[model samples]
Target: MARRRKGRAISGVLLLNKPTGISSNKALQKVRAMLFASKGGHTGNLDPMATGLLPLCFGEATKFSSYLLDADKAYIACARLGQVSDTGDADGEIIHERSVPELSIEQLQQVMQGFVGAIEQVPPMYSALKQNGQPLYKLAREGKTVERKARPVTIYSIELINWQAPDLTFSVRCSKGTYVRTLAEDIGEQLGCGAHLISLHRTHTGGFEAAEMISMDQLQQVRDDEGSIDHYLLPADILVSHFAKKNLSAAETARILHGQDIANTENLTGMVRLYDPEQQFLGLAEASETGRLMPRRLIVTDETVTD
Candidate 1:
């Protein structure tokens, strides 16, 4: 006998304040079960030892995850100046430890300047990046080290918040794929000492900030009180605000909904925000060299559907 399933309609994002020591996937699953959502995914990952805002996309919003993934991120990290770890953060075994140098605030500030602007970084071994169809962390667990190519990433801003005995707390605004652990290690090496990240917290990614985030407990409370959870969602187009806007006529909107490439967009080159005749957000599109707007990610045809 086939089991009949009840239709579950859940869509939109839940901004979760992920606590330290919980994996991003675990948090996503917990939120999924709480919402009873059929489809759910996270836009970006926060490491197990890292805490703070993790955007979980559910239902139709999951389709536009790439936009969120590519957005820039902000973090606050504490670096232990006298230690190095296999996993780069505090969770792993200490591979090496040394005495921290007497670092003055000014000297630390000077060192931080070198990291601003564009910089090259080698990905940490304790990461999800795959090589030869296997995760690099798996190889690292076996005490094997592999050559990793340095990737170019921009550090939009880095500020030293405080300096204490053997720890330094700082905030960073960086492009996607920037590793705070690697940055800490590199800073330590430059200062003639080795270091590792002791703590990490993502404060923002794209337009999503920790201040505006809701937790799993809060979502559960909302569900219990209202008999529905409806207040946790942000507009899907929030991550694509950096792109240019292109409003389409009703005819164009109909054509686009039918998967027809739009022609005659004016002076657009990169990812563009699309709006329909009713001023409703459609999705993202790219302007072709021939002046056609090609759809990249379309979430829903009706903007009011988010509610």
Candidate 2:
């Protein structure tokens, strides 16, 4: 294993309460510059109009980012009824509008119930999905259309937060890769009224919550405190607590470092968190057979690889 130097490049996870109007990558860049991280990456992408929990990995922690991207997410989003946007969000122009029909709470509640559970959704044209050599958004900008297949997605829970006039706010907990904008459009279609997202705030992702996130102002305060900025960072395994843990002895650690699989521990199944004797995070591994843990991903040096 490569030894990390102190004050060179910090390693760990930064839970950022991403503010609205900033793309997820842009937010990562800002945090990277603030920490002066030599390497960094975010688990998932949040739209520019959305705000909330965005977990950023710095230095060696970037190796484990893929696991975070696979976790579920929760968000609070407001959708405007009787109005349809070209981009399915407030950033798009309103291309269609109609008067809000008299909708009773019970009737609206019934429509929401139908949206629960597993469903297939066709991705919107104004998405980052790539086709041929260009992004779908580029085609949408040029007034071109293409057939998009529906993808299966799951909704764990959705609750109506509040509603007044044409504005309806709802909280949704869904699997990763789900599109809340598409959900809003589908809900509108079910209600016989077009809709689009007006505001979106993610509350949770990859087991990280907004309440645990630090703001840019708080980070600045820590930075100005002289040398305590590193104290604000959480351990890289924070989000991986959901997985089982395996403590490796010196011999086992040596074997793993040599890329050899060891006998699995009984009762251990699925992905697990691997640690050194001192409980320092080593990386991630999967349990196979009755007694063997095979390395799935390891935290190597921060040498960037390009094709």
Which tens-of-lDDT digit does each residue in 218-299 have in candidate 2?
Answer: 8877778765667767887786789989998977777776667887755689988888787767777888865778877766
- Model 1 collision count: 0
Candidate 2 regions with alpha-carbon error over 4 angstroms: 1-7, 224-227, 300-307
Model 1 scores what on Cα lDDT?
Answer: 0.85
Clash statistics: count for each candidate: 0, 4
- Look at candidate 1 and give me any clashing residue pairs: none
- TM-score leader: 2
At residue 251, candidate 2 shows an lDDT of 77
Shift of residue 251 alpha carbon in model 2, Å: 0.8
Tell me the spans in candidate 1 whose CA falls farther than 4 Å from its real position: 1-7, 224-227, 300-307
Model 1 Cα lDDT, one tens digit per residue, 218-290:
7778877876665677666666677898889988887777666898548788888889988877877888888
